[model samples]
Target chain A: MLLMIPGPVHLHERIQLAMAKPMIGHRTKDFSEILEYCTEMLKKLFGTKHDVFIISGSGTAGMEAAIACFSKVKRITCIDNGKFGDRLGKIAERYTEVDVVRFEWGKSIELDEVEKSLAEGSEALAFVHNETSTGILNPARELAKIAKKYDALVIMDGITSVGGDYVAMDEWGVDVAIVGSQKCIGAPPGLCAVAVNDRAWEFYNEKCPFYLDLKAYKKKLEDWQTPYTPAVSLFFALQEALKIIEEEGLENRIRRHRELSAFVRKWVEEAGLELFPELNEYSQYSNTVTAIKMPEGITDKELRGELKEKYGILISGGQEHLKGKIFRIGTMGNVTIRDVVTTLACIERILVKRGIIKPVLGEIEA
Target chain B: MLLMIPGPVHLHERIQLAMAKPMIGHRTKDFSEILEYCTEMLKKLFGTKHDVFIISGSGTAGMEAAIACFSKVKRITCIDNGKFGDRLGKIAERYTEVDVVRFEWGKSIELDEVEKSLAEGSEALAFVHNETSTGILNPARELAKIAKKYDALVIMDGITSVGGDYVAMDEWGVDVAIVGSQKCIGAPPGLCAVAVNDRAWEFYNEKCPFYLDLKAYKKKLEDWQTPYTPAVSLFFALQEALKIIEEEGLENRIRRHRELSAFVRKWVEEAGLELFPELNEYSQYSNTVTAIKMPEGITDKELRGELKEKYGILISGGQEHLKGKIFRIGTMGNVTIRDVVTTLACIERILVKRGIIKPVLGEIEA
Candidate 1:
């Protein structure tokens, strides 16, 4: 079965075999070598000169680490334009006082509002670079620039954007950025890589949660080790996945993601469907996933369920309040042009069967 | 190569193959069914009626969760007799005020001292059930009983002991217990199973680290899901490992661990080697691993290095100040008599080559 969700995406056979390799002692030289290689590759994927620590939890764990370790200010400003952005705010609230700038699920955040909030004693700004839930890519570079003017540390959740899109973390002055293994890196779930700028260490919270403490990770990386026992097999898989990323070249991979997502958007328009996120000058469509409004006359169940049961394809439906109103097609991590075409074909077939739209000539074949 | 260290032990072929399985969406019904199965099997392995939440991390993360979530008190008494025990105290100190009762490594803690410490306004007691570092099993039942007398909560780290030994969490009044996938469960490292008694919920700290929060785990378990995206491939491997445990029968598995450890002890005596831990009536040697003092004519390098270079076997040496003073053999998770015999033969050959001991008749064959 093909996995077209935002994460836990389709796995390559090489990665699967890597995951099956025998376990080694986490403290051994062999494991350390693997850790070092993965760390180096992750630094490339994150576009950072700083150290990127591999955490043995999901992406949200990395988000929590980013906030709990660096949110040492009197108040932090968080942008909540979608589910993941809202999560950043929630996690930050647990660490310090938070001022959450809220927006509708598929709407872009106002830059003036973010700047105003940061002006009010907020020492940090946290936001999601690509909001997977709403399929919107927030203006990370612009936000980081705004935060820099206010002398506020910028924390970005690059989970769905880092490997698949252009995320120049160091160039954009992102103090802390996070990515998930199951997304563009295309390994598996359970590992989160966090990149921290050297300057961000000044805001480190000594009382941060022990398991997710970035300081411990940094100190241990000096010896090519994790502070705690890592999921050794997952590391093996991640190394292989990173090798695949390196082989493809970051620029080429980003081009593929952009091309596929643009293709999906074009298909939605041709098939009489609307894009979910309301795009503005600053906000753009996510390169990794496309959220489309459910076409008229076809229920979400009829559209998604038929795709899964009949075509062995899995796509994601809208989450939270947007449930049943939208559908998402993820084209991240090892996704090819053929896979996208097949998915579009299946969606078109389902819509045709439901009498939602007339079949377009040559579009299904394309 | 054989893995005879405390964890990341020898993995069965089934478990490795299971890890190679394709990824699945964490929110899907199929994944939830797998989660439900693993949770039930983990409950049985932990010998508890309470819920067991699976965290996608190493065993140390589980230890941190146990302490951070439940150490909400004026002072939590932590036991520090070995490396793992000291870690429990260190993690507890970050969340709450801690009174660590220190003891010499491999030495039994004084029960009277523990009682006195608990009597001094401590509201909880945290300790390791199996001190894998020194190959000793602390008196978990007795400690829980003592903590109960003071009406304090009991938290136990059963990382290396839960599946290989008899750990009756509910019966022993253990408020919270943790186990690792790599140890007695016979899976790869990466997943940690935590069992929480219903009564332990009252002490839950809302400020606990967001990623490792027990309350979030409990709430998500109601829907047969994890709070965050789990390590999907690791969960597949763990489920397969749990199946192997169920087939072996918990009582028989514990019996095998006990018998193998006893065999190791007898071999130590026959080889004129001393046990590492100073055992007492209240303290016993660990069933999952055996620690032996370095003999007279053999350096740790000569013994362990030869075991690894000449013979394809891996064992653990001492940590911290005890480094080079002792070596440990782990017999947890699918360890067989033949494996033990082969390891013993290798050790005997190294000792004889180094002029440390005379070869015994029929012992090498056994």
Candidate 2:
């Protein structure tokens, strides 16, 4: 079976084997060595020389940690252009006063609006770098520059973007950035890596959840250990997955993601379908997933169900209000051109049979 | 190498192979079915027909969740007899005013002192059912009875005791109970199962950490899903481990744990070693792990180091202030009489070579 969802992506055999390794005590020297190696590899994947902490929960847990630990301001500005961006705002609201700049799903963020909100006593700016739900990559570099002008700390959710795309966290002045192992890192779900700039410590709040407290994580990392018992097997799998990333250089891996996503986008256009997200000068299409608008007559159940039952392929449909309107095809992690071609071929077969598009000469085999 | 530590005990080949299974999206029907099965199995293991929520973090995360979600009182009584018991108090202090009834590391709790503390307007009682650090099983039933007399909630940390012992949570009136995957269940670490009685919901606090919030878990369980993306691979391993427990029968599993712990206790007596924790009429020895006093003139480094280096056996030494005074051997989840006998033999050989014990005729082979 093929997994083409935004996250919990396909796992490599090496990672699966790593996960199967015998259990070991987390307090032992052997486990500490593995933690150290994984921490260093995660630093490289996050594009930061600053501290990176591995958490045992999902990407959403990392998102909560980033907000709860660092949001010590009177008010924070959150930009919500999609599902994940909205989640950032919701989590921030729980910690402090939040000013959420909301946008329609799949629509681009307005830079002026973000700046204006930050100007109104907002001491921090929280947003998602890549909105996986809508297949749009927000302008992280430009947003950081704007936040810097207002002297606001910048927190970015790089879960779907970090390993698969270019994320210059330190260069962009991102105070805190988060990534999920199941996404572009190609490990199983349950681990989250959070990178923090040294300056971000100034905003640390003691009221953060005890288990997700950043201060505890930083202190424990001195000995290459997690504050609490980590999911040891997940760490093993993550280390192997990061090693795979190291083998194929980060730049090369990013190129692969870009190429595969581009292939999917081209196929959508050739097959007479429209891209889901609307982009501006700063906003761009996500390099890890491609979202296409569903045709007028095809229902989500019919299309996705047929794909899963008949072709053994799994992809995600639109979430929340966009349900049945857009379907997404993920191209992150260990995805190859062959996988993308097969998915596109299956989609073409379904559409042609539904009378949504006419079969082109030689295109069916291609 | 054998894992004789309290947690992260020896895992079976079935559980390891289960961890190696391919990834699946958490939102899919296939994954939901797996979640439903694991939840039902966990309910039985917890000995509660109430709601059980799975969190994708360590047991400590579940500990914090139990305290942060339910401690909505003027003051809560926390029992501190060992490392984990102390942790319960510390986490509770973060949520509410805490009255900690402290005891020595290897001493048992006094029932009268607990009643007096609860009498002073403490609306809840938080304690560890099994103090893994000192290898003592606290009197969970008696403590719950005391809390019920004062109309207080009962929160128990059953991390190392739930699967290996008879934890009648419903009968004992335990409002909230927690278990870890790395303990007697013999699954890999990183997942925590929390069972919440229906009445406990009345004490729910909105200030709980977003990632570990019990309310969110309860709401999501209606759809047979976790509020956040779970550690997918760990869930697979846990399901397999729980299946093994089902096949073995819970009563038989508890009996095995009890018999193995008794065997260790008998060996300790014959070797002229003392049990670590001083027990009372209500308190008892743990069925999962055995704590033994270090012999005179034998340092922890010498005894444990020799076991690891020469025998490839892993055991735990005392923690914190008791660092060199005691050593613990675990007999939980898939551990057999042969494994215990082999460990005992290795310890006997080390003691004889160090002149700490005399080699008796026919006893060495036994």
lDDT of 2 by residue, B1-366 (tens): 888888788889999999899888889887898889989988888899999999999999999989999977889999999999999998887889999999998899999999999998899999999999999999999999999999999999999998999999999999999999999988888999899998898898887888888899889989998888889999899989999999999999999999989988888887778999999998999999999999997799999999989999999999899899999999988898888887888888899998887654236333
Docking class of 1: high
The clash count of every prediction, one per candidate, is: 0, 0
Put down candidate 1 lDDT per residue, B1-366, tens digits, no spaces. 788898889889899999888888888899999999999998988889988999998898899888888867889999999999899988998889999999999998788899999999899999999999898999999999999999999999999999999999999999999999999999988899889998888898888888898889888989999999999999999889889988999999999999988888888887788999998889999999998998888788888899988998999999899899999999999889888888988998999887787776246323
**Alpha-carbon shift of residue A79 in model 2 (angstroms):** 1.1
lDDT of each: 0.90, 0.91
Residue B195 of model 1, lDDT score: 95
How do the predictions measure up, each by TM-score?
0.98, 0.98
- Scored by TM against the true chain B, the candidates give 0.98, 0.98
Candidate 2 lDDT, tens digit per residue, A138-181?
Answer: 99999999999999999999999989999999999999999999
TM-score of chain A of each: 0.98, 0.98
